[model samples]
Target: MAICNQSQFKPISISPKTNHLSNFNLQISRSQTLLKCHNNNTSSLPTKTLKIEPLPLFTSVRSFAPATVANLGPGFDFLGCAVDGIGDYVTLNVDPEVQPGQISISDINGVGNSGKLSKNPLWNCAGIAAISVMRMLGVQSVGLSISLEKGLPLGSGLGSSAASAAAAAVAVNEMFGGVLSESELVLAGLESEAKVSGYHADNVAPAIMGGFVLIRSYDPLDIIQLRFPMEKELFFVLVNPDFEAPTKKMRAVLPSEIAMSDHIWNSSQAGSLVAAVLQGDLRGLGKALSSDRIVEPKRAPLIPGMGAVKNAAIGAGAFGCTISGAGPTAVAVTDNEQKGRDIGEKMVEAFWREGNLKATATVRSLDRVGARLISSNS
Candidate 1:
């Protein structure tokens, strides 16, 4: 509805010197010797019997950062994107005595639930994923300490939790000489997610592989990476109302059954939205984005002034407005950061008027690069 037009795009760069998250250290590598299966193996050792070796200590420190956005419109539990605008960091160091099954986290920084941080590896999704990946690779005994730096806000619909889980899994894999494939790492990441958000691969997959992903199936997990094709400039504004709406609560509110017409409409919109993104058709994408017939309407009422905020963003030149993940936070797309800021201001104003609640809005861009190895100097 609301569209903002401006000329300048903000300069985006990655900075390494400044530490936004708490510093951490650790390493994951394979065991050096193979276990003998039988005396016959001395003459013809089976390939499976090959000894797993521990990777040499990292030549330099390394960091893995992942960008993520949950509930990408109609594909609740089935779609997500690695947003370049925000992410989390994992720093690890090698400890020969640390053993693979053991993982310790220190230097927990950023805004996170302190109680959640204090838990052991078995309870922490991120820690579990990291440790699991290492063990599966035959690094049975890894000794390392991890420092998790959370950049995204907790429970803000920004996928902060997923990013942390993804980054840890990825960083540990890379630290261990890349023992796992991209998809394998995603599977490991989802193991952590299952502990909290149930068995969902949409968010974790994208965070690992990067780009726009379509979760075609869940059980045997099928994922498709969609290319972003846009001729016109595109940007995003993230506005979190500083509230928490658990994904579980939102999913519970959704109807397990939907009208035939609603299903057809939502399917069409999802298909069209994917096509529009690939075609670089901003207007079509916007229309499709706002065309969710199943989830938004039912859950919006729970988010205070969602309607007013959406209306205000549209009025202020946002291509379209939608709940960021579940509820509370809203996302607006525009051509430039300047317009995004303006739209964010208007959206916040609208929320104040309708729900009498204050909200925070930030201008951002689609993160095309996804999760990346920023530097090895952990």
Candidate 2:
């Protein structure tokens, strides 16, 4: 999810520059019905659960959560998968001398934040998640110190904040004796994510649980976990351009409604993508991923060089390509790492030659192990 940077917001005022008619209409509609439409139907969906390893009970612990790619074309706000080799890390230490159930931030520095990230627990994603865990567990007198190490770039559409939230949730949970289940920890992480990103689970769920996760419903948090067959080999080529797409602005551009025909088309593609994941059908997955007629069409134009980079990827033998998370970071899938690297090169070149943007690409597989403890002092 593309988190709206807090600093990016300013006092609302009429601008001398006029919005295009289409945009003006969309924003008007969003403002009108955004609140009243969310009537919570009490009808409940069956809940799903996830289980994770308990770290050794210790006074201090460090946890790592992998980066994630959300949306997956048609599965907006639901489908996501943890990426290997890139993510955020959190370190927690028991501070008995401080007030009970209070979490203090010792440091938050990494990636490209340059000290811009908030140190306040309430404002920071990691801090918020950790504090939520404390409240959930009825923590009375345990003070924890947190240190964040960001390995993922901020707002790259790679679930940077979600990674931080997941790592913090895991770190805090383990530090407090591992009382929370995987599902509960995900819920804790979601609490923080909802404060920054829109209320969605696509990023936080996968970052906490790992694997490919389908959020069946947000009401009861029904997460249907799926995986590729062991025999099937797939890799994700993530190309992040030098750009930031704020979540608020990205969402503001979307239409509130779609034609029934378009709805059915996206539904079919979403189901096909799920089936592809189940059967290890990389080709099918790619087709479904690239065939989204809804969000991608609207979002592609917003990202510079997206169309040409996608074409370059497919022509270079990528199974399929689409925008990852929100924008600026386009993702492609393939069966071969070498092929993925080549695709990355093509996409990177397109970003420079076509979009005039410099970008970096990394090839990685899915991370089956989500957030986990690295070290702890028993």
Candidate 3:
């Protein structure tokens, strides 16, 4: 949904000063309450025994797509949501005779074949999903292969890689007679998250399953999937500065101990944002989205003219503007595409005027549909 309305909204209070990060030990206690919320609900169906009837050992190709956003506003590593516009598609095929634990990249095309996926297990979303699927099913000798069609930009904070992991997991599960439950797949995606940036599923979970998801805790796999209220139009103007910020570097820059006051401020803002979305208060939602007190300030400086771009977007009637992902890329939310386009133009103009650099911005509607299985071929 559009985070802000073009004419009706204005940025209320914004601090342009760079945040002074404190170096201290910050231990975020895992809250299993998030998980309990999902499992304890009476509406949820009880786990059913698998009615396995093996038809054939032949190969079947399936596709899965996931929406993702890491470092969503105040939560940093903890908060992420799957937007509709961007994601990854994975086509998986199972070959029973190929032996279990065997994975071959028969034909790697498009987004993930830069040899980067081959380097580290974490960076390769496909690899992580494969590992998780195998581990979960206790399969040791089934051969498999995956093809990825990546629609999202890599390193744009769009959960491009996480989409691959979610897609691969879903596709693999379907190929295996849907043995892995939805929760199991979510857990698998979270496990794969460790390959890239520690372990978290704020992005992957929602990407696998549509709608707004709250990751209350990661350990013991506590994932809460909540349905976002309908009647909201969440549009995204994703502006890529074509600059890359390492996720690890951004993590390192985070303040270990935030002031209790700042923490409260962020908490209120987050809560308000959530409420705004639920209430279908587009104006309020926009205001809340831009009112991030935690990471944006500390991280904006890394993007050359982020400050100017943000100001320009605000000037151009954007609800709020902030860096997308770790940035170089930024986002401006508006009620309509035209406003988003105008804001994007202003953002690029601001970058040029202030940083003497060129930037690109693409506008899209918020994707309510997370990931889906496109096809299965025998």
Candidate 4:
């Protein structure tokens, strides 16, 4: 993880912005008034609504969590957004017959190298996350069995480990009757991420909470859900080179201390980006997204053809382009789907032309729903 300058942390200052809040509040008030009128006119009304029973304790539960793009250029280890269509699925089953406090990895598939993974709970991201959730919830007697289905490539800078950890945490929480809140589940996922990557919620927070998330502070683990312009047609272009950029290696290349001017510039850019997103200023957002002076300059050299790829993406009509997380993957933002696709293809072509590396590119929307239970069997 890149070290952030905490002394420069400041609130984003923006003018008051209009959203759908007034319309939503108006609709709620009208509905309440109509309900009151109906009750006054009716002789009798049912006071009790139908009660839906909760499902019985399930032996197994399956969940899926979307891939996330962290940093977003300037907000290192703080800002993240969940991307649609690519993610990881995990199934966690309770084994009552097994010894207490035991976790087993029954199966792993989809990103290759299943045989290379360790079965121990302490080693595997999904297993460790599931076990952490169970322990946090005080479910001591139930043993856990985890199965991971990787939809995203490992070490591709697409929050692959975070997705698995988040899915496992959500699956285990669902199997245990959904006792854990979203924040608690995020913390469980963070535990696994800490073991594998580093103790940062930039990826895990959005993977669990969905959409855009800002990690305000790590001391108290403050996560704020930021609103995106849902009315606008925003798309993401993801280009992944056929190579791996290990998170540790990426972090190792970054300087331990940054210049004060660089820190202030990054802070201002990040704040502007957040404010633009909140204000629905797409043009301002694009400028802010493209302005990253600190991390990207140091990390771009590590990724082959990163400079050309970003230039191609911008030339093809993307709002901005930057390293997705640690790199080997580059992300571009656009308002039109066709433009996003074009940007993706251009990025892939640039990667091949510049570095002779074959890459894959895809355009996807933002995933608003984060980790969710896809299936369950009691």
Candidate 5:
């Protein structure tokens, strides 16, 4: 159930100077859509002509958006996938007490420094997204109160902010009867993500749509949903060390220009990673995931235990391992939870022994369901 929109939020502009992704771009428009899907799942955006549906309107609604791993190796700022079992929750309540059409943050509490998050709609990710939805709906007199529950650790490269923004966007849309399309929801989330994180949809797109999303373009906002092989069951080993690598800082370390050789090499690897996922070649996937010649090398050194943890995961038979999203959190993919846990143990031990950093490890499967309504009431 989704619809697309062209309503762009102000003060949050997307840069148009970026290159395009290697995948085919699909557009979801406000009136109609070129994006295709089989049924309800937005993740099924491969090839079937489908209609969009919005959630039922409610006076109060709670929504959830899963955490995501952006970049997915060489597909930096373009590819990402949602992780199951961990995310952020947001609840929206119609408030006649507040000014009509304005948004207010009534509460915020979760993992990381939730207490430190701003309450202003202009500053908060959830608030910003909610407001974006309000604009999309053209409601200048309907007041809404937002409550956020942070499940993902902030600055841990787990799409924490994106989850909050996605949840809040969907919550607001649900309140007004799901008129906004899926692309509109993503656009709303992107408004918040670009303000806080860099101007990229790699994190927010997958957080809103679920599963894997490949960003084909930015200017017109073209997206393509990429799904792994249905027969292959992939497990993610996420180890979040008690370290903060802000998105701003991590992005700062990236080089402005890379050699042509490096570009070719990384391009090939990115292609292989996508192919491996499609063909169920775990070994290929791992090699491609770990073979980032440019971004990972520079970023890895910044995260104290990253190099050792990556080595540890590979040593423990992980299919592929690399820094998740930004950094400080290392993510590895494998075929089984048992193997994933074993890899996680080695990575954790490596962080302690080498980097002298404490880390927590969790294993989860790929989230087929991205952002969804958790509960609602009149």
Candidate 6:
């Protein structure tokens, strides 16, 4: 289904000077005076110029992007949170010998079917994102090889593709002297995600920016990084069933249009969720999360024993339970780490006993750090 439109909600104003990075340190922010001859009259005007700096020739660069959970129930594509412990790592190697503007996939590990992954840049998420980063920086030519180590399961509703894309974009941007801004890197990741799934930034935003992200608007690209409560301890339980919920298929099953009543309900829940998060009201946040009236209802039938699993989690003292992304994976929240573990195991057991599906569960705290460079070799 199409994500909820931001126009439906009241506009949320945010400052541009927030902690999020905007431009690379090397990128020129000053305007240069240029002389223009108009109608035989010389006129002096300021023009923007993107200054390119020569970067150190690095042999290899490695980066990591954390896994994320999008939708978060009521907010759909507008909301997302990063998960710790699981993510994707990408290593980019410059191949000056090869033709510029070409990217080759040298190796892929972690995710299954390595042979199935295309070597062509356009077909690969990491390669495409890296190439997009190069294009964004006005780099006409670049030749590189990429290696992916997928830590998250494919189609696990864990933002696997986004992690790969974010890691690749960050690595490529870093290798090129970090010219792209944080938002620009998200755009690069979106380019890759568009090719793989649909063009949406819910997963990409949090994967690159960390914490909780509210995609206020797609046009003009307004992304707000919500402050997560560091004072309050929060835990998450992620249960992955032995089945893939391909995004395309899940989207296809959703209704093309939602009722106005449902829209209003969802918008209310979404607003409440944002407020609860900011106020550190875990109980209210959990209620808002489980109160989706639109997408989940339509999609729940696709997942076997989803109702039972959710019930088990809630019964086990989870704040709430909901499907993560386009799920076959379900996520639950809790304040206590031990309770979170119990919820996770209970959810997994429900999937197996009730749904007759084998699954695994993990308990993780939120990852505040998004994507970053791990190591680089010159």
Q: Model 2, which residues run further than 4 Å from truth?
A: 1-56
Candidate lDDT scores, in order, read 0.68, 0.81, 0.64, 0.79, 0.82, 0.79
lDDT of prediction 2: 0.81
As for TM-score, the candidate ahead, 1 or 5, is: 5
Candidate 1: tens digits of C-alpha lDDT, residues 176-281: 6554556566777778888867778777778887767777765555667777764556777787885678888887898989999999999888888788777877
lDDT for residue 313 in candidate 2, whole number 0-100 = 97
Whichever of 3 and 6 has more TM-score, that candidate is 6
Q: Which candidate number would show the highest TM-score if scored against the true structure?
A: 6
- The true-versus-predicted C-alpha distance at residue 307 of model 4, in Å, is 0.2
User: Which is superior by TM-score, 1 or 6?
Assistant: 6
Each candidate structure's TM-score, on Cα atoms with residue i matched to residue i, is 0.83, 0.84, 0.79, 0.84, 0.86, 0.88
lDDT of 3: 0.64
Specify the poorest-scoring 10-residue window by lDDT in model 5. 18-27
Candidate of highest lDDT: 5
lDDT of 2 by residue, 118-155 (tens): 88889899999998877655555557888999998778
The deviation in Å at residue 49 for candidate 1 is 4.8
TM-score of candidate 6 versus the correct structure, residues matched by position: 0.88
C-alpha RMSD values across all candidates:
11.3, 14.4, 13.3, 11.4, 8.6, 7.3
lDDT of 6 by residue, 266-317 (tens): 9999999999888878898789889999988888789997889999999998
In angstroms, the error of model 2 at 145 is 0.9
lDDT of 2 at 252: 82
Runs in model 5 lying further than 4 Å from the true structure: 1-56
How would you order the candidates by lDDT, starting with the best?
Answer: 5, 2, 6, 4, 1, 3
Model 4 TM-score? Answer: 0.84
